[model samples]
Target: MNYMDDFPMLNKDIVYFDNGATTLKPKSVIKAMDDYYLNYSSNAHRGDYKISLKVNDAYEGVREKVKKLINAKSSNEIVFTSGSTDSLNMIVYGYFKNKLNKDDEVLVTKSEHASNILPWYELSNEMGININYIPLTENHTVTLDNVIKSITPKTKVISIAHVTNVIGDVRPIKEIIEYAHKNNILVVIDGAQSVGHIKVDVQDMDIDFLAFSAHKMLGPTGVGVLYGKYDLLNELIPTRYGGGMNISFTSKDEIEYKELPYKLEAGTQNIAGVIGLGAAIDYINNVGINNIEETCDSLKEYIISGLKSIPHIKVYNENVEGSIVTFNVKDVFAQDTAIYLDKYNICVRSGSHCAKKLEDELGIKNTCRISIYFYNTKEDADKLINALKNENILEESLGV
Candidate 1:
């Protein structure tokens, strides 16, 4: 019940509402990292020493945990990358390299984060494939109709975010996946926002690929997961190659690469981060993701309602449903609001939040975003609302 008790950072009396950006790690996750460094901190899968074996086992164990977390068919389907951006780039490059031609198209939605959008944009430019955009509804939600309208015979891939980071709108992923499958188009989901907050089943959803970051889910940074079907993953060429990924090498003419996940994971892997992510997964399991979802959503509803009551404030994506509440006070800059909130030990995010295209489309320069996680309480929401209500921007800025 007392989730905050498990996070050392929460004890500082700071109201942390920036879960969409990254979550504060739990004590168990921190301890997991500490234990790794203290005990078996060795290069994984390289040497025959006992420490190497232990470290390798610990690193591989996180793959199993991730497999279970997303209900993937096998651990081999998961590839470790630097972060969601790395994973997205890998998917875009590896999957589309030989398949796409000059006239081919890659469909992506406007709601996509920059990580998801830019990689494909670059790929399309390099490969001479036309990049097609799926228009968002007036409410900024992507619908099946838009998918249907966007996909043509030349469409080879459809990439979109599972959840829109700006509006907090959950896309109809299953339906989109089904449509893509019917059209023989690969579906790559930017699961960076969705994985930690919602239940994800790669098999059930029939998604070709999904990308997520560990840091957003109470895990360490520099660790990300890319889940693809085993056969598809095998078909994807290695975007990066080096030590620990090759099975054998003979002179300058011959080389044999390792298996699925390892082939994608080049160089020395993030062993400690992966281990900490495993612990974070275990922590989420104990807390029950469903319960976390309900708790955060309840808090979001409460906060958004309170924000709406403020006359001069305009809440972006008020109709969208999720744990993020984006708004701006009248005659106040978004960054100024964030700065003022920081004085009360409140942490919130401002600006375009890495979705430059979405912000441009909406004509919003920036918006203050309050993102909640399972650890946030209704009391925290109350504090945020009360702080906003009590503060006068003119007075605060001028010391009047």
Candidate 2:
């Protein structure tokens, strides 16, 4: 598929390998948002006019699309939020905070993004719960053995990323979820990196809670989804309160809150972002998620092989499978390598990548990450390889 025509940014003179941060927006998603603003710019559930009615339909319609995207049980299972960070915060503070007692443990990994870790950290401090780590294998990948070993009698919840943003290793989520269920533990999956690149079926996995951002999957920013089972999700207290989430309220302690998702979402909401997310789902369905994953895997293998052939290039996570390749130019700082690559019109991410503790596992604090999407071609790989092959990379990066 010719994705260059669809993504406006691709036509520019640059190779983007930062999909883990966010994917490029497709034209269809942009057009949908534009149409929403130009045609029906009305607040949802607040008016009975024609455009407002249309806004409600488009807004709620995206909920159904999200439900089908993840094979969720019902549309009510999806609650829109600001982003994956907001969704995870809701899961941690809104639900788990009230459920866990003092000294209860929640399992997470070092490779998890900060959004997944920090919320749990705050919850642990407030509730006196222990935050535990699921040991990663020598390859920095989680195994069922490690998960089993990490779970103790006090372990009430297992919170982890379906795919680690730092290493891009796809965790054995199904096996882990199955084992956790057997031990009567609820699982919270951070699907920010996985949902956009791979197939995720909440029903098949029996996931307790799932969170992901639309921007990472070719949709606009400021829109995300928090998916939970109907019964468990309803148990979550509304972290925020306002209009559109209640039916009636009075000074005499007479307040009736809405149910399920509406109870969780209590504001004007991001109407344009929601419509764009629906369009993004439509685009993904047309291209096929499996096809996108396969393309990324093939490209990743090729890129890794090319980088490995360069003597000065040290590739990390080379054995790990996924759309990301982490490496460093020997004797050059990670950010310096990123700056040098920018000289060649290539884009890559550097630094700790929001997984600060991953340094304990890697024994290195920083590495350049190349997170690919389906749109990236082998030519992008060639450009990056050639740039690494050039002489005086250290001096050039140092501006000497």
Candidate 3:
């Protein structure tokens, strides 16, 4: 099924293959945000006025929507933040800082995004915790056997991305989480690339903490979610302390904070973005997540099959699951390939893709990534292939 009509960006005469970065917002998501700004513009959960109450309802409604989207135990477990980076920071400092000890260890893969790995790096430096990598297979994907061999008695946390942004390898999270739990370790999932493309059931997977962005999943920018189990999330201290989260404050030493989700949501939120996120979730549910995954899976296969015929294009993640296809055009620098593709009105991402440590595993520092979404088509792949087939690619991209 064609989703061209739903996204206004499709009319711009460009092939959008940078879905891993951010997706084009659907009309429904746009309309929802517009309606919030145009119809009822007021501070939520403040003032007893009618519009304020309406704003309160709409803002809080998105929390429930997110809870259902991931099948969390309660809406109380959902905490809204700026984006995945913000959410990961909160999870690392707000929750783990106090719980973890100096000698404790945290396990992560080199392929994780900066959002997932850097925070742990900061925490490790500050708290004297050891950070270790779970060895990846030859395909640059994680295996359950490797996870077992990496863990030690001091391994208190296992944090990794559900689907790596660069290699597009979907980790064996369920098996990893189960093993971690048996060893009394907590599992934190960076779901920025996984939540939108695949079905995420927090309960079934027994995830301890999950972070994701709204913009990557067809919602507005400046909004994201941090999902934690009730007891665990309740223990997380508020990273940002401000109004809308406190019940009472006497002197410097006396203050009363609210419960569960509200305690974490300090200060005024991105109300319009939250409402748009609700609409995006609605749009995905209407189209069915399974259908979206199927479309990407099939399109990825078709594109990989065609790319193999081109000698210069060295495709990475060909055997990996999900929609992302990583490659480089032999002697051409990744960024030059990107610039050349832009001339053809086809867009693709080229770089370390915020996974700088990934170079250790992939054996290359830079690559061009074609991350597909449900909205991309076979025609888009054809255009990319045709452009790569040109022998003058190096000279043309270099403007020589």
The residue-level lDDT of candidate 3 at 317 comes to: 86
| Candidate 2 error regions (>4 Å) | none
What is the overall TM-score of model 1 with all chains considered together?
0.97
Rank all candidate structures by their lDDT, best first, as comma-separated numbers: 3, 2, 1
Q: What digit string (tens of lDDT, one per residue) describes model 1 on residues 167-233?
A: 8888899999998898898999999988978898999999899999999999999999999999888
Clashes of 2: 0
| Residue pairs with backbone overlap in model 3 | none
lDDT of 2 by residue, 22-56 (tens): 99999999999999999999999888799999999
Tens digit per residue, CA lDDT, model 3, 1-400: 3478889999899999999999999999999999989999989878799999999999999999999999999999999999999999999999999899999999999999999988998998898999999999999999999999999999999999999999998888999999999999999999999997999999999999999999999999999999999999999999999998999999879999999899999998999999999999998898899998999999999999999999988998898998899999989999999999999999999999999999998889999999998999899989999999998887898766
Q: RMSD to native for every prediction?
A: 1.4, 0.9, 0.9
Query: lDDT, candidate 3, residue 294?
Result: 96
**What is the C-alpha local distance difference test score of each model?**
0.88, 0.93, 0.93
State in Å the error of residue 372, model 2. Answer: 0.3
lDDT of 1 at 129: 83
